[model samples]
Target chain A: MVRVALYTLLGVMSVVMVAPLVYMVSLSLQTEAETLSAQAVLWPENPQWGNYAELFVKAPFGDFIVNSFVVAGGITLAHLLFDPLVGYVFAKFRFPLRNTLFVALLATLMVPFFVRMIPLYVLMAQLGWLNTFQGLITPFLMDAFGIFLMRQFIQPIPDDLISAARVDGASEFTIYRKIILPQTKPALAVLGLFTFVFQWNEFLWPLVATTTPEMRTIPVGLTLFNQEYFTLWHLTAAGSVILFVPTAILFLVSQRYFVRGITLTGLR
Target chain B: MSLSARYARTAYLFLLPALVFFTAFFYVPIANVIATSLHTGPQADVFAGLSNYADALADPSVRHSFLVTLGFSGGVVAGSLVFGLLLALVLDQPLKGRVTFRAMLLVPYLTSVAIVGLLWRNILDPQLGILNRLGLDQQWLNEHPLATIVGVTLWQTVGYTMVLFLAGLQGIPETYQEAARIDGASAWQRFWRITLPLLAPTTLFVSVMAVISGLQAFGQAYIITNGGPGDATDLSVFHIYATAFKTRDFGYSSAQSVLLLVVIVLFTLMQLRAGKRGEVTY
Candidate 1:
């Protein structure tokens, strides 16, 4: 009886957690009139999978998705390269001021990006990099969070493994490339996914950075879509699905990493 | 190649990229923000002392914004503490298919805030929303704006806090619970004495993250209420964005942002101090 009650509780909680997403899909398939009707409709008579395609036409969402992928992917790859290298330096090397430097980086983590927005925007505008991919990609190509998380993972790697490589005349670069990189794959995935998802959902920065529709990211584009077509809930829901799918797929494939990442860093 | 060699030159090589990034992106922007915060003229070239900050502090809008953010963060921390812990305790049971349930719960945390905000806006739409048709026909966004923000945010992030708590719960020695039980302690007593105390660090961590994220909230304000029917949801970040971009008052915006950062750092330090007091060494 207790077991049945437990299952029932979890089952209800799961529905609460998932109902919005399920409703989004259902709403996306409905007609505009059906969506705005006084009575709520859980299912549409006709499923407009065509709404997904029409979303592409209503806006350059295809380009926006590609922009999101490029910018987010570019930032993730940069973090994967530099963060671990930095983490290895902090983890293995006993440099003077190492702790000070590490703490300095961590301190920046406390300073939210919004605090730096005005000047960062002006700085970009000064460089005439506004509305450009480089403007969106370059500034955040590195982050302190990745370095912090990577250091946590790399600290547990055995010292003797690196020592063995160094005794074999392996340069520091090769040791980091071959030993630390492979060992920290789990950390890398965690960092990469969090950074990618964070950047993909990034709205304010992209909205501030890119003025042209050509450079809009999915989140920014979708916000504009909702604003312009406030009554068109079906179309807006379709756009939400498009914005949501890649992250959903990522979570499904790496469910363990997302949970582990939260426990590891509580990163958002 | 000796491990004892003092300060390897190659270590700097590994750190060079990060150092460059911090200097250019992090440190420089910080310097620029502070410098801009000190100026107040129309062109913003004229140097003004603390007047911009003084002006911002005396402004009712700024004060209201900070209060709204405080209420929002407080609600989020309180809600997450209660519901998130409850969910964690439930999931910690040896129930069947809990992994799948855990995954389902975490989907919102994995989702974008923009999407989450828009979804809630649709659900709670006054005229044609599902909730109203289902009898929650109140003016949700207008009448109870902060609670509405808290509700959606908890819906999105309770899973995150639950998972953290679950990790903390799993880390506790099982023997402790068993020992308490053997001593004839009731399940509730054991939870109150043993489990909750051990979960302090995780609880602190969750509160700190939730508060900091809450104070800097923007997407919900921008998308859902546009800072609201009458500035009820005018959160700090949202207000700062408007003061900077919409009002074109960069000097004042920078001042407000600096103030917001000080508030975040202060809250974090206080929590860390309290966390240290509550920390259990065992």
Candidate 2:
């Protein structure tokens, strides 16, 4: 009897959790008239596959997808290259003011992005970067969390490996390039995926940073769709599906790493 | 040079790029925010002192926004915590399709907030929404704006909290519960004594995170209600955004941002204190 109750509860919660996503796809496939009809069906009698086609033609959604990829991919690549290096040095090398600097980096983690939003926007405007890719990507190129994550991941590598490499006349850069980078793949994967999904889903900054329709990322781009077609549920749903596809695919591909990343970063 | 000295030099060289980037983007911008908050004018360079803060604090709309923000965060934190813990406990049981359920639960967390806002707005539409079709005909985004936004946020976030709690739950040694059972403890007693105490760290972490994110929640409100029904759902972050962008009051917006910074910093300090108290250690 207890077991039955547990399953039923789990079953219900799962349905509640997943129904919105299912409904989103279902709504996207229905015509506007069908969706608004009194006898609206959960699943459209005739699935309007044409809504997806119409969305692409009406808006620069294809450009939004491309822009999202460019921005997310750029941030991910920058972090992949820079953060690990910073983490390696902090983990393996000792220096004056090292602890202070490390603490400073960690301190930035507490400074919420919204606090910096206005000034950052002003800074971007001053730099002539508004409505530009650099505006979207530069401020977030290297995050405190990425550096901290890398430091934690890299600290576990034995010091002897670096010492041995030093004894063998390998330069510090060589040791980092060859040894530290190779050993920290799991951490790097987690960081990269986290950064990608974050940048891909980022709304506020991208919304403010880019003014032109051509430069908008997927999330910000969808808001335009929302404004222009407030009543067109099918097209908006289609746009939402487009916005969600990349992050969903990444989540599915690296499910375990994504969970591990969240736990390690203490972020959702 | 000594080996230690050489290592220090090399390390500084290695750290140069990140330090420069951070100084320009993070440190300088934060400093600019502070400076801007104190000054008047569009450029925000002219010295005006605390009038911007005075105006922000005195504004009824700003005060309403603060209350709305608190209410939204409170609802989300409470709902997500209770439901998340329950879901985690349920998933902890030996059950079929556990992995699938976990994956399904994580879907909303992975989706973009814009997409979530759109999806939920569609789902809660008064005329065509599934909820309305089920005979719940209330205007979700208009009349019950806070509840609607909170419900959407809870749906998107509860799974994340559940995952964290699941990790916490699994980390708990089974012996405690088993021993409690042997000692004639009821399930409720065992939960209260063994489970709750052990899960305190996770609870603290989850709540702190929820509070921080909930306070800064803008995307959902922006998309769903546009801080609508006469500012019924206007949050602090959205208020700040409007002050800066809509009203072109960069100084006042910066002041509001400073206030938000104070709130976030306080919560973060609490988290740090909790960490120091060793409650987070399992």
Candidate 3:
């Protein structure tokens, strides 16, 4: 009886979690007229693939996808290249303000994004960066959270690896490239995947920073779709499913790394 | 060059990019926010003292927005955590087809917040929603505004919080439970005394994350209710957006933003304090 109850609970929770996503896929494939009808069908009676086709053909969705790709890609590369390096410096080097710098990174975490959004907007405006790809990419490139995560992962590595590389007359850059970077591959992958997903799904900042249709990322584009298709349930669901595909693919591929990232969150 | 000097140079080289971004994006903008809040008028380059904050405080809409934010945040945090913990406990038991169930549970967490908002808005729409199809034709948002929003947000987030708890539960060593069983403890007693105490760290983690996220509850309010039914669910972030963009009151918005920062920071400090207490006891 106890076992049955537990299974039932898990089953119900699983359904609750995935039902909306399934509903999205279902609605996306439905013809406009069918979707609008009072007769609700869990699965579309006829699957029309043209919704995805119209997204690109009629709207600037292709531009949105490209913009998202470029921005998320840039942020991921920046995080992977810079995070571990800074993490290494903070972890290994005996710099004068090492502790202070590390503490500063942690301190920034406390200042919620709400506090910073307005100022960030003004700063972007002042720099003439608003409505530009630079505005979308630069602010997000090197997250404090990524740096902190990398630092934690790097701290546990033995110092001997670095010393041994140095003893063989490796340049400092060479030592980092040859020794530290290779060893921290797992951390880098996790950080990269995280930065990518976050950049892709980000809404408020992109909405605020970008003005033109060209500058909008996937989330903002989807928001625009929502606004334009206010009463069109099928199109809204289709847009959402379209947005979900790349993120879902990325999540599935990097799920193990994603799990690792989640594990590290509990560490601090 | 000496090896130590070379390494130092390398370290700084590695640090430059991240430091530059952080300074420009994080520190500089935050300083700008502080400056803008303290200044007012056409240029906003002139300094005015405490006027914006004073105005923000005096504005009833701002106060009402804060209250609405509090109500929404409170409901989301409480509802998600309770349901999440219950689901986690249930899933922790060894069961058939658990892996698939676990993956399904994580689907909600992976779904974009915008998509979640859009999906739920339709799900609870007074007229055409599937909820109506089940013969439960009620105005989910209009009738019980806070409850409706909270219910949807909880539905989206509970799975996420549950997975986190499940990870924490699985981390607990089996020996502790075995020892408790040997001592003739009842299942309830063992859970209360042994399991709960051990789950402190996870609880602390969930508390800080949930509260911080709760205080920043904007997406659901923005996409679903649009802070409607007469500002019933206007979160602070939404207010900041409106004040800055809609009203063009940059100074006033900055001050309001500062209020949100203060609220979150205080909650974080409180969580840290409670977490530390648990650490000491353990």
Candidate 4:
């Protein structure tokens, strides 16, 4: 009886967790009249396909999607290259100030990104990078979290492999490239997913930094769409569904990495 | 290669980019903000002692914003953790066909916070929402908007917290539970004295992550409420954005940011202390 009750509870809670998503998908496909009907439709009677088309026609969502991809992709690539190299050095090499630098990086993690907003914005404005992809991606491309993630993963790799590569007259860069980088696919997949999802959903910096519609990411763009078409819930839902697709696909493909990343990060 | 020279060169090579980027992008900008906050007038050269801090302290909006921000964050942390742990415990049960359920629960964590905010705003829409259609006619936005926003945040993050908890639960040794059962402990007692205590480290880690993430919250409020219905959800970060860009009071905004950072640091310190206390428990 207790076992049966436990299953029932989990079954119910899981439904509650997923109901909003299901409802959003359902509402996106429902006609305005049907959506606003006195009785809610759990499943749409007639799924409207035009709402998805109207997302692009009615709003600047296509540009938003492109902007999201570019910013997220740029940040992920930068982190992958920069963090791993730094992490590899931190893990393998023991030098003066090594401990200091590592501590400084970890300390940097504690300082809230909120603290630097005003100064960063002013700096961006001064550099004429505001409302540009460079401004959106540059500051965020290399982060403490990525470095920390890379450091945690790289610390586990054996030293003898790098030593063997070094004995073969390989330069430090070559050792990092050939020896360390290849072994980091799993970590990279995890970090890449995180960075991509984070940047794709990033709203504040994009909203403040980008004045032009062309540079707006999907989240900020979706907000503008919400404000512009407050009356059109169907269209808004459709646009949200569109924004969700890439992230959902990425998560599905990288589920194991996501699971491992979350677990290891928590373990620390 | 000698140890000293090879170490020096390799260290410099490894640290170059991260140090440059970190200093320029993060530390220097923060330092500039502090300097800017102290400066006065258009030239921003003359130091005005403690004036910006005084002004920020006196501002009712900042104070109110701090209170509201605390309330919202506290609600999210509590809600997410409780719901998440509950779901985690359920999912951790030895049951048939649990894998599919686990995947379904994780979908929300995978969804973008932006989409989650937008989805919930409409999900709780006053007139035409499915919630209203189901005869729950309380005005989620106007009447109890704060709770509504908190509910949305909890829904979105519960999955994430649950996954962490699930991992933590799995890490608990089976022998401990067996020993407890052999000693005549009931299941609930075993969970309370054994499982919960063993899970302290995970709980501490999750709590710290939750608190820090909660303190820096931006996307959800910006998307859902836009700190709306007359500034009910005017969180500190949102206020900082408004002050810097909308009002163009960069100096004042910097002060606000400092104050916000101090609050987060204090919270982090408290969590670290609590985590230490838990370490003693084991």
Candidate 5:
């Protein structure tokens, strides 16, 4: 009886959580009429695969998807390129103000984006980066959390590997390239995956950074689609499905890392 | 140079690029925001000290938005947390399909906030929502704007807090609970006497995160109601966004930004304080 009650509770919570997603997909595939009618249309009578294609014709949704990928992918790749390099230094190197610098990074990590968004916007405007991909991507390219994550992963690397390489006259840069880079690939991947998903779901910065329709990422772009075509629930759901797909797939594949990502960084 | 000095040199060399980005992206802009808050004008060229903050504090909409935000955050933090702890406790019990259930629960959180907001907007629409046709009818978003968004956010975020709590629950050794069970303690007693005390650190961490994120919530307020039917759901960030973008009042917005920053930073300090206290004796 106790076990039954527990499963029932889990069942209800899971269904509650999963139901909206199911409804979203189902709603996406319905005809506009089905969505509009007073009666509920839980499933499309015939899945309107055309709504997906319709989004592109109605707007530059193809551009929105590409922009989402490019910005998210750009930020992820940038983190991959830079985070480990900085993380490696902080993890292994003994430098002046190193602890202070890392602590400062952590402090900045705690500073929510909402706090700096206005000044950052003003700064972006000053630089004429508004409505540009760089404007959307640059500020996020290297965050303190990425560096911190990489540092935690890199800290465990045995010092002997670097020492051994140095004994053979490997330059410090060479040691980083030869020894540390390969060793930190998993950390790099985790950071990359987390950054990509996090950035992809990102609404506020992209919403602030990109004013033009073409520059908007999926989330921002979809909001406009949602507002403009609020009557056509099917099309709205279609736009939503586009925004939701990549993230759902990524989260399932790397569920563990995503958990660790949040638990460690307290970021989504 | 000494070897240690040389190592430091190389470390700084490697660190140079990041420090530049940090300064350019993180520190400089942050410092500039605080600096921006201190000034005023169309050009933001005037050195008007504290007046913008005074204006921001006195403005009724600003006051309303802040209170709404506090209420929203309080609801989300408290509700999601209690539900999260309960769910985590349930999942902690030995059960079948627990792993699958855990992963399935995170779907809402895994999806983007904008999309989640839109999804529920359709489902909870007053005119023709599915729930209405299904006989569970209410003007959810219209009448209870704050509660509706809070409910949506709780639905989305409870999974995240659950995972944190689950990790905390697992960290606890089986011996203590087992001992409590043998001493004729009910499950409730074991939970109160043993589980709750051991889970303090996780509770602190989760509460701080919930509070910080709660205070910073924007996408829902932005996407769901556009800060709502009246100024009902105008979250602080949305209000800040409006002050900066809509009204072109950077000075006022930046002042509010600093104030919000103070709240986030205080909660962060609290988190940081308890961060070192995670070690618990059996």
Candidate 6:
């Protein structure tokens, strides 16, 4: 009896959780008249695949997707490369001011991005980087969280592995490349996925940084699309789906790592 | 050369990129924000100490924005915790489809906030919303705007909090519950005596995170209502954005941003105090 109650509760909660996404897709499939009709249906009688096609035609949505990929991809690549390098140093190397530097990075994590927004915008504007990809991508290229995550993951590798490599006359960079890099692949994956999803879904900074439609990322572009075409629910839903589906796929493909990433960073 | 010196040099080489980036992007900008907050004008060269802060504090809109921010954060934190803990407990059961349910719930979290705002805005539209068709005629975005924003934020965030709680729940050893069960403790008694006490740390962490994110909420208000219907849903961050970007009040916005930082720091300190007072050795 208890088991039945639990399943039923879970079933209702799952529907409530998933209803918006279902509604989004369903609304996207409806014609404009059907969408604005007096009676709203969960599923449209006639599926309108044309809404998806209309998204590309109505806006430079294809460019927005490309921009999203490029920005997210660039940030992820930078994090994968730089964060692990710094993490490896903090993990394996006994260096001057290492602990202090690590603490400083952790402290930076506490300073919310909003505090720096005005000045960062000014700096970007001064550098003539406003509306540019570099403006959107540069400040976020390497974050304190990524470095911290990489350090925790890299600390577990045995010291002897690095010692042996050094004794064989391997350089620090080579050791990082050959031994540490391969060992830290799982951490790298987690950091990479986290950065990618974050950058892809990032809205405020991109919205603030980029002004032109062409420079806008998927989320920003879709929002602008909504603001302009507020009444067209079908097109707006389609645009949201276009912006959302890629990240959803990424999350599903690496659901385990995504959850682990949240739990690991969440505690800190 | 000493071994330590060699290691230090190599480490410095590795650290160069991060240090440079942090200096250029993080440290300098923060210093600039503080420096600018005390000054006047777009160029911000003229010194006008505390004036911007005074203006920001005295402004009715700013005061209203802070109140709305508090209400919104409080609602989100409460809603997420209550609902999230319940969902976590339900999913913790050895049900056959728990994994599938958990994954399905996480879709909202994976979706972007901007998209969430757009989707919810459509769903809550008074004239054309499906909810209206179901006999609810309230204007969600316009009427009870704070509740609407909080509900949308809860939708996007509760799954994440659930995942965190689930991890915490799983970390708890089964032996304690089993021992309580063997001692003739009812399920409610076991939960109240054993589980609730143990879950305190996770609860604190989740609430702190929710509060921090809630205070910083912007996209929902900006996207859904544009802080509209007479500033009903204007939040601190969105207010700051308007002051700085829309109204071209950099100094004032910087002051507001400083105040926000202060609010966040106080919350963090409170969490530290709570964590210290409620330190569970287990």
Q: What DockQ does each listed candidate score?
A: 0.71, 0.79, 0.67, 0.72, 0.77, 0.82
Query: TM-score of predicted model 1?
Result: 0.96
Evaluated against the true structure, the overall lDDT of model 5 is 0.87
Model 6 iRMSD vs. native = 1.1
- Summarize candidate 6's per-residue lDDT along A1-268 as a digit string, tens digits: 9998888888887888798898999989999998888877779877999999998999999899989999999999999989999988888888778889888888888888888789999999999999998999998979988888888888989999889999999988999999889988888888888888888999999989998999999899999988898798899899888888888888878989988888987666
Which pairs clash in the backbone of model 4? Answer: none
**By TM-score, how accurate is candidate 4?**
0.95
Model 2: per-residue Cα lDDT over B126-238, one tens digit each: 88787887677778677788988999999888888988999989889999899999999999999988898888878888888888999999998788888987888998999
Candidate 3 clash total? 0
Candidate 2: docking tier: medium
Against the reference, the lDDT scores of all candidates come to 0.88, 0.88, 0.80, 0.82, 0.87, 0.89
Instruction: State the weakest 10-residue window (summed lDDT) of model 1 chain B.
Output: B1-10
Candidate 3 versus the native: TM-score? 0.96
RMSD of each: 1.9, 1.8, 1.7, 1.9, 1.9, 1.3
Q: Which of the predicted structures, 1 or 5, would earn the higher DockQ when compared with the native? A: 5
lDDT of 5 by residue, A118-164 (tens): 87888889899999988888988898878888888889999999899
Off by over 4 Å in 2: B271-282
DockQ head-to-head 1 vs 3, winner = 1
Q: Model 3 Cα displacement at A217 (Å)? A: 1.2
- How badly does each model clash, as a count of residue pairs? 0, 0, 0, 0, 0, 0
Superposed by TM-score, candidate 6 places the C-alpha of residue B276 at a distance from the truth, in angstroms, of 1.5
Leading candidate by lDDT? 6
Give the runs in model 4 whose Cα sits over 4 Å from its true position: B1-3, B40-46, B280-282
Worst 10 residues of 3 chain A by lDDT: A259-268
Q: Model 3 off-target regions past 4 Å? A: B1-6, B280-282
**Docking class of predicted structure 6:** high
lDDT of 3 at B14: 73
For B69-146, candidate 6 gives per-residue lDDT tens digits of 999999998998899899999999888977899998887898898888888888888888889977887886777888
Q: Candidate 6: where is the Cα deviation over 4 Å? A: none
Q: Which tens-of-lDDT digit does each residue in A178-242 have in candidate 3?
A: 88888888888878877788788888888889888877887888877787768778878887887
TM-score of each model, paired residue for residue:
0.96, 0.97, 0.96, 0.95, 0.96, 0.98
